[model samples]
Target chain A: MLEIFARLATLVVHDLIGLEAGTGLGDAAHFFVEDTLKILFLLAVLIYLIALVRASLNVERVRAFLAGKAQILGYLLGSTFGAVTPFCSCSSVPLFIGFASARIPVGVTMAFLITSPMINEVAVVLLWGLLGWELTLIYIAVGFLVGMLGGAFLDAIRAERYLQPFLAQAYQQGSAAAAGGGEAQRLTLRQRHDFARKEVGEIFGRVWKWVLIGVALGAALHGFVPDGWIEENLGAGHWWQVPAAVLVGIPLYTNITGVVPVMESLILKGLPIGTTLAFCMSTVAASFPEFVLLKQVMLWRLLAILFALLLVAFTLSGWLLNLVEPWLTTGAGAGG
Target chain B: MREIKVLGSGCAKCNNTAERIEAKASELGVEARVTKETSPEALMQYGVMSTPAVVVDGQLVHSGSMPEPGQIQEWLQ
Candidate 1:
């Protein structure tokens, strides 16, 4: 269905615009049009549907649900909710304080926080659209694993001791009362439509530029890079490349919406899947700005620890995925 | 006079929420005092996990999104 649109666009560009097929500019133009249309269409539809389902879910209710749950179950549910929940980064501080004061385990809260950015609906939809299902499933599984294990490890080390002074005091006092946000009431169809429409507008407004920028970058690579150049230079999947890709991604900040398209082009160009995944994940999740935001809640030591933890997780997963690349890609190559 | 506090991390949306409330109050000829509360402590006190949450005279009334003009008019009244 979507390929038909790409083909139609290519026809229009080539026939009407007098651009020759197979030329760099022609291919780049076709790529930009096709990907931009596909991404925007998918994002709007998926976001609206997800928002309708999410109308009843909120951070307060999630806090109420996770509080006092069993340890392992708490982490699992926390990470699960993080994946499904629609969270804004601006609310992180308040959410952190609320969770901490409610006496939810620090690790569980960390699980939620870590998974929130890594496995959002936007990320899932984009990955599925750009990469094939096998890779998407693996990415989701890795995201959940990282969150769960990271949380458990933090708990084992008693990481709550590293909270900022005021947060520690709040935790000790347990000043938070019931975490509930009133009982859920069934919404009328009209209410759901309004909410979903607003959500589509808000989210689309925020991410459309990212989609364009990402697809444009992907188009540039698809157009200009010489064939077999990447394979000859970097396709060996050397173990050291994973860590280097991770380190390179640390300083650059972008969202998953902006990185998935780039990932598509990299894999198509013969870069190792694991190295590309590591670079993209690092770009999305591990960044200076996000850590700076967390500094409001966590002490410097804890922040550093979190940073190192993410780097290690991304590197390890990259390596593991690279080791299994042969089996993973036997039948499935990166899809458009 | 009513006191309206917009609680958030001082993001653009938070500022816009504060401005909207202030504009609505004056437009409705309702005497109101508005403030932007960026403190996490204030957010905790109100049990708000999202922002820009609205606190009218110490009572949290709405949260997690931008306020509509109609909602602001209702708040003022």
Candidate 2:
């Protein structure tokens, strides 16, 4: 699909736009057009599918299920749902509000928030296209585990003690109100479709510019950045590369849409898989904005714990990938 | 004409809120212009920490989740 889109973009740029190949302008434009179209196309399709699944997941059903689940299971379910659910990136506020209002466990909600942005369908599609299916699957599995374990650990530590008092009070009131009217409303197919369509529109509206900017950066790096610079600085030889990638990634925030192309370029240029994955995961999962959003409901301590937990988890993931990359590449070449 | 803005990020509930507001305004035989704000900054500016919020004229009538149909009707009127 990406190849076809790349070809179409090439045809348009070379034939329609009349831009000659090998020039800086031609290369950048070609990269931009191709990358943007591929990302957008994947975004629309994946988000729609996720929306369909989410519609069936139904808020009331999820709340009811969580209310009855075991402690470990709740964290696992929260993060697993977060990975598959479509709303993690921009719509987290509402999910947070919903979970709080329903009086879902704070730790469980934290798990969901952590996994949602990290492993949504959009991120998976991009990873599959850009990095291949094996890595995408691996990312999904590992990312889900991170959320589950992270949430469980936090809960065990009684992290709830750290949430803002006002939020808990609000949650208590919210739960009281919701209890009186808590009923599942089955949505028709058309309603689900409309909901999905608008979700696509809303996300597209916010991130379209970032897609361009990210792709442009990727393209620029592809065309101009010295080939060995990334590899030599941050590639396989250095054991510190994974941690460094995580640290750098936190301060630099970009969604999978913006980060994936850059990831593709770096991979093609021999940047080590572990370092790259760590950076990608950190950029999407452990960033400052997510923590900032958490602050609305949590005191500094809980927010700090979440960040530390994610940073550690992501760093471990990076090292684990480093250890397994050779075995993975030798075995399957990561989805041929 | 009443200027009503649905402050949200284009999520499911936001779309529903926008539609209900439009429908309620129309049902009441009121002339109204409704706008959807999908920008995060703009939505947050209206204090919509949670989405599917309603801004009537320039004031925040509701924020953080969808309002009930009855509430929508009251706001529109």
Candidate 3:
């Protein structure tokens, strides 16, 4: 159905408008219209469905649940909760302090914080729609591992000692003085529907421009980059390429919404899958503004450690995935 | 007079919530002072995990989103 719409659009632009098929402008116009329609439709449906299923879930509940859990399980659950929770970066300071004051371990809170930016439902939906299930699953796994492992590492180093003095004291004193969350209320179907509809509006409103800008960039890359040029010059053969992509990603910032379309274009352009994913993940998760916000709760030492941890994780994942890329694509083709 | 504090990390929603409360207070002819507290310490003290939380006269009344206009009027009155 979506394909038919895209085709009709292409036909209108190509025949009714008199743009030739092979021209750069013509092809880009087709790519832009098709991608915009497909991505927006997918985003609205998937976000609403996901929101409906988890409408009862909120940060307060997540905090209460994660507080005082066992170490390993806490890390896993924290990362999982992070992915499912809809968190704005500005909430990081309050959320961080709230979790810390509740006596949740630094590592567990860090796990939630790390994964929250990298793997939200919107990110998952965009990845699945643009890159297919195999890559989406892999991206999720990588996000979890990065969060869990990073959290564990912070714990091993006793990262709590480096927190802002008040938080460190709060952690040490085991102050459950913070407001315990309200009891969970069962929601009617109507309430869930209302929540999901509002979610659709807010999330779509925030990301629609990102979709246009991202797809425009992708279409430009698709139409203009000579086929096979990237494969020949920037393929998996180069060891430094992965880290280079990650390094380039550090200064640039965009949410996963804006980066996924670019990821699709890069992969299709024959840039290695691992390299593309690494770059996009770094851009979304490891930007300066996020770190600055985190600085409210964390001292510089801990902040620096997190920065390095993310860079290393992205680079390593990039290399590992590139090594296994042919196998992955083959498996995806067969199964997905 | 009521002392209303909007707690958040200075996000746009926090500002908007403060504005709405202030507007509703005057419209209702209630003498209310609406303030934005951006400090993480203030939020931690209140135990607010989700933000744009509203504290009316030193008690948390609403949180997690911008207050509806009805909620604003109720708070003022």
Candidate 4:
């Protein structure tokens, strides 16, 4: 019995030492935890700052501005403004309600809603960071044009009647606030700070889980997915791959920030810029969550219009990306 | 005091709009009570189909756009 016990202990000790030398599991765990925590903290701080900035905005003035503009002009302006604003798809819904209630042209409101998520500052920054300046500029310009043209098309259809009944109620609330004649009060610096903190906490509290999940998936794909397979399957000149990628993106929902890392990895692996961009846009603009939220404000017909617009926009953007990929990649490789 | 409500489904934008309103109000030295209304029923009641709809003193002020800080300050004044 004593001899058997000694043999077993020796075997266990040898296996443990071998595993430690080969894997360094402890070190990897520590790194992962450290990196993830850093990301989480940064996200929190960003959320707080963004929230504070958003909180200071004047909704009534925007309403007044939109209300006074012509339909086509309103849409163009709204689209332009939306590109500068940082709201995501889900967050844009309230803005949609406000615009609709204010009796802003449906086309203009839709333009703003679409552009707000598709062509945000973060998206632009990430695109520039990962893809370079020309592609980033193209993305912004094309995205803005898509929003403007799409809104014009929808407006021609006179799609306003299709807004859900609740939108009217939302308008009523805005009017009620305006009616109260309390629009003259102001806030102090301390109050603004508290508001910013609370707003950031609340917003981040709800969406952080989704952000983390998206990041985790992106990280896994980045680390584990085979670069060779992606290049062969989805590389330029694959006619069917563009549509397939766009289709693949529709069901998946993630913020641009979460998608950026994966995009960076794919580009490194020789995936075409346009195709990857289409996929990213589809995921962000045509997400299931975004559609679900729209159900509250838009009827089926209106939703269909938005969906078709996204599909066409993404497809066109992808095609355009393919056209320039050769030149961009060559320039980048030579420069590097 | 004027009553205000920020309506949203708890997304980041909604939260941002809410905070903006608070900041704007504070900047203008407005003595208004601001609240966040996240319930679907309350949103529906206010005809808010989106998250982060701002209702000031029981009126709906903004719904879709994140208003500029100076503009919000103007509204508060």
Candidate 5:
């Protein structure tokens, strides 16, 4: 598939535009252009499709669906909703309020919140395209586990008291309005098209700069970063590598789709699967901006705990994957 | 009269927000001009990173989701 892109890219850049393509610098330039186009195309199409699906629904339906479920069911449903929902992490606040006002437990809400950012369709699709099926499945499973367990842990500790007081007041206000019964209107096809076009523009416009930067960095790493140095320092066998990756990844703002190529390059430079994926997960799921936004509704202690939970879960997942990787490789060898 | 800017990417929620503001404004007997800003740059000008923000008279009144009718009414006044 990438070969097909490469051939088409060569025809356009080299044949049509008559640019250089047979040298090292040319290859790097081509790689960058190809990757950028690929990601942008993918982002535009997938985001538009997701927006189309999202356009047909309202928050009230999501609220009603999740309002009265048990803890485990809430965790399951919340995580699933988070997975498919097109919401950016910070933008999910209204849904968070809906859950709160509906009296859904804080843990369940956290489950929704965590998974929404961590394992959205963008991440899943990109991981599948770049990293293949096993890794993608692992990402999904770990994301779900983190949401479910993190939520349950928060609930077990009675974290509701840690919410900002205004959340309750706001929820009460919002709930009263909701209970008064407003009708949900269906959007016309033209309206859905316009909405999707606008959403595609918004998301693609915001993330394109990051995509270019990420691809450029990935190209550089692919070309210049040495394998031996990386393997010696941060290879799979290193016990501290997973936690270190998580800590470093926490401050970065790139999404999984943006980070996967860089990760692919790092893997070429001998970075471990566990460590690379750990970095990707934390970068997307545990960023500092997400915490800053949550502070509007949650006390610092609860936010800190939530961060810590993700940190621990990702680190453990990394270590466990590293442990099982050799066995999986051998199993594959035997089977295939 | 009020200048109500709905900071959204023109998604359903944002449209809903714009409509609700219009509804609330008329229901309360307030004459208001409602506009929707879909551009990221325009949204940033209002310091709204999230879509579907309601800005009334150039002050950001709400963001991060659809504003309820009551919240819209509260903000408009």
Candidate 6:
């Protein structure tokens, strides 16, 4: 009995501090705990900042303006504007909520939401710098067209009816406040500065967790996933691979900046350009997290439409790449 | 003091709105304090739902799209 008690106590102490007394399990457990804790702490700080920003938004005036715009024009403008923005996935959600609360036509808002992550100046510059002018121009034109058309399609569906009851009510309240032209409150310079700080914090807070999760997932895949399998299975001549890659990508999200390096590495490792591009598009344009965030503002029906549009767009882009792969490689490879 | 807030998540449209507002303020020589608001909370408080929203004197003047520089200047006046 005395010997057993001593062994148990030793085991407990070892496990508690990840020392593994006499075994190697303690070291592995310690490493895992340390890495995970670090990630968790970083994510916590990031989310706190995002939440601070989100809490500070003024939704009423935005709702009033949305009520005034032409739905189609709004969608077109939203999509076009989304393409020019420099926002990452997390920052885009607050913007999405603002549109929804503002009562901007759902379809148009969807258009902006979709295009914002897909097309951007950074992505464009990177694509051009890494790929070439031809591919870059094509991506921009296609991305913009898809956003415009997708928004119009969603608008035609009258997708706004799907908002959660609570969000809808909040939107109404905001509109009402705007209509009353409530007493204008002015903020002093110091107040505005404070407001800005809080806002950045709030926005960052809400999104940091998602960003970390995404980064961790990406990092894990980067570290452990076998590129040869993806290359062999999804490479050219496989018609189904295009759609499959896009479908796989929709659930995954990452910024173009993070994805570009991985993509470059994959391409170098014999991964099909089309497969890699499809993956990139899916990660950015149709991310699951983006959908989850958009759900806060949009109804299910509109979200579905947005998803379908992205699916088709990304699939087509992948397929088209396969078609032109031979020519592009021949022309571009010589320079490389 | 006049307060102007540009709301968007540091995207191109948001930046454009900010630039336009600055240009408008400069052109009119309006004594308004111009600031960029990228927080979801601040944007929601103003009822702005789109990227690149322009709020003048705590009133949301534009949302969902970037207003032209000329139009922004007009709004400033």
Retained true contacts (fraction), each candidate? 0.78, 0.19, 0.88, 0.31, 0.06, 0.44
TM-score of each: 0.96, 0.78, 0.95, 0.67, 0.77, 0.54
Ten-residue stretch with the least lDDT total in model 5 chain A: A327-336
Q: Which stretches of model 5 miss by more than 4 angstroms? A: A9-27, A168-185, A328-336, B3-77
What i-RMS does every model get? 1.1, 6.4, 1.0, 4.1, 8.9, 5.3
Tens digits of lDDT, candidate 3, B27-72: 8889988889988788877778788999999998988888899888
Report how far off residue A77 is in candidate 3 (Å): 0.4
Candidate 6 per-residue lDDT, tens place, A44-153, comes to 44344433333333433323444567766676677766764435564555655555555566677667767877775545644554455766666676677777787787
lDDT assessment of candidate 3? 0.85
Q: Please, what are the lDDT tens digits per residue for candidate 3 over residues A1-336?
A: 446646876777787887778887887777787778878888899889998998998888888888778999999999999998987788888888878888888999999988998999888877776678889899999999999999999999999999999889887876764446646879999999999999999888878998899989988987788888998999878999988899889767786788888888888878888898899999888778878888889999999898888889999999999989888753321211
Question: What digit string (tens of lDDT, one per residue) describes model 4 on residues A1-336?
Answer: 123332333344335433232233432332223324444555566556665565545444555556758766887788877775556565556567667666677788878877777776556654664456776776678778878888888879877767776665554444433322214337677777777787666556555665566546544544456657777876789766777788889878877666754565566567787887788778876778878877877889888878877887788888887887777633221211
User: TM-score, chain A, per candidate?
Assistant: 0.96, 0.87, 0.93, 0.74, 0.87, 0.60
> What tens-digit string does per-residue lDDT give for candidate 1 at A108-227?
998998888789988998788778788899889988998999999998989999998888888887778555664675898889889999999988888889888999998898888976
Superior candidate under TM-score, 1 versus 5: 1
Q: What's the ranking of the predictions by DockQ, best on top?
A: 3, 1, 4, 6, 2, 5
Name the candidate, 2 or 6, with the larger TM-score value: 2
- Cα RMSD of all models vs. native, in order, equals 1.6, 5.8, 2.1, 11.1, 7.2, 15.4
**TM-score (2 decimals) of chain A in model 2:** 0.87
> What is the C-alpha lDDT profile of model 5 across A140-176, one tens digit per residue?
9988998888889998998887877766554444442
RMSD of 4: 11.1
- Badly placed stretches (over 4 Å) of model 1 are A330-333
Docking quality (DockQ) for each candidate:
0.78, 0.18, 0.85, 0.20, 0.11, 0.19
> For model 1, what share of native contacts is present?
0.78
Look at candidate 2 and tell me the lDDT of residue A14: 86
lDDT (Cα, tens digit) per residue for candidate 2, span A1-336: 468887988898988998878776787678778888888888888777778756656444555566646778889889877766555444665556556656677779878878887887778878887778777877788888888888888878977678677556656665422342235568999989977887788678767887888899888977676768876776676778788788889867887789888877777667777777788888988666667665656789887777778778888998888888887742222321
On DockQ, the stronger of 1 and 2 is: 1
lDDT tens digits, residues B1-77, model 1? 99999999888899999999888888889999999988777887887888889999888999989999999888888
First chain of candidate 5, TM-score: 0.87
